[model samples]
Target: MPFSFPTGAARFVAATACALALTSLVGCSNGEGGGGDSTTESATSPSKSGGTQVTINDFKFQPASLTVSPGAKVTVVNNDTTTHTLTASKGGSFDTGDIDPGKSATFTAPSKPGDFPYTCTIHPLMKGTLTVE
Candidate 1:
């Protein structure tokens, strides 16, 4: 028996197939509401925009959490290709409805001091926390 290497076209086909298979395996999903699969970004982490903004990208919250003073004007920027929202999960305290791709929305942080968890109404699995100080 003899062994031969794949030709250039054959190698290209194999590489492409592998690439596509990997892409599908890791494609982002607008997941259903569930336990957060994300980590809360510390209060000291760099802010997205002037310390009053959060970003939505790759089907996840950029910080996955935030801290701000009460009644702060927080901006939600949707950098993902799809629409998203940052909505309060508990008491409907805040919601940035249907932030389209490249669009932004602003909501006031609750006047009360506490931890307010939020999620994307469209993809609830994407969750975050907002701390009102």
Candidate 2:
């Protein structure tokens, strides 16, 4: 004898499972995780050492532009499926070689106030700006 779900229960269960799986995938796909809009800003509190965080999600940096105090430590977190790099556009200053998915890297902000632009060496089109105050 074989057992099975009642009526359309099996179909409903399968559909629900697929929906859930897609939901999870969507979050990693663009880093918004249902948060909506890739351009939205995501702020992080400064740590004891005056460190702050920037999230790399869905191929775009959350809070694409960040302003922090001089000498503050900025942590870059990769929440996407692929590896990413946060390299200074002009070289030197700070660079996170390669950050794997779900991984993170840290760098110190310039001690002087200025605008520092960065991009993913792997994905040149992915860009961000850091403002040191």
User: How many clashes in each candidate?
Assistant: 0, 1
Number of the top lDDT candidate: 1
Q: How large an RMSD does model 1 have?
A: 6.3
lDDT tens per residue, model 1, 1-133: 8987678999899888887787457545534344667344655243465558888877878777788898888888899767888999998999998999999999888999999989898776787889888
- Estimate the lDDT of model 2: 0.78
Clashing pairs in 1: none
lDDT comparing candidate 1 with the true structure: 0.80
Off by over 4 Å in 1: 1-38, 44-51
Each candidate: what lDDT? 0.80, 0.78
lDDT of 2 by residue, 1-133 (tens): 9986655877889888888787566442334354555564535546445578888877888767888888888888899767999888985778999999999999888898898888888877677788887
The number of the candidate with the highest TM-score is 1
- For candidate 1, give the lDDT of residue 108: 86
Where is the poorest 10-residue window by lDDT in model 1? 38-47
Off by over 4 Å in 2: 1-50
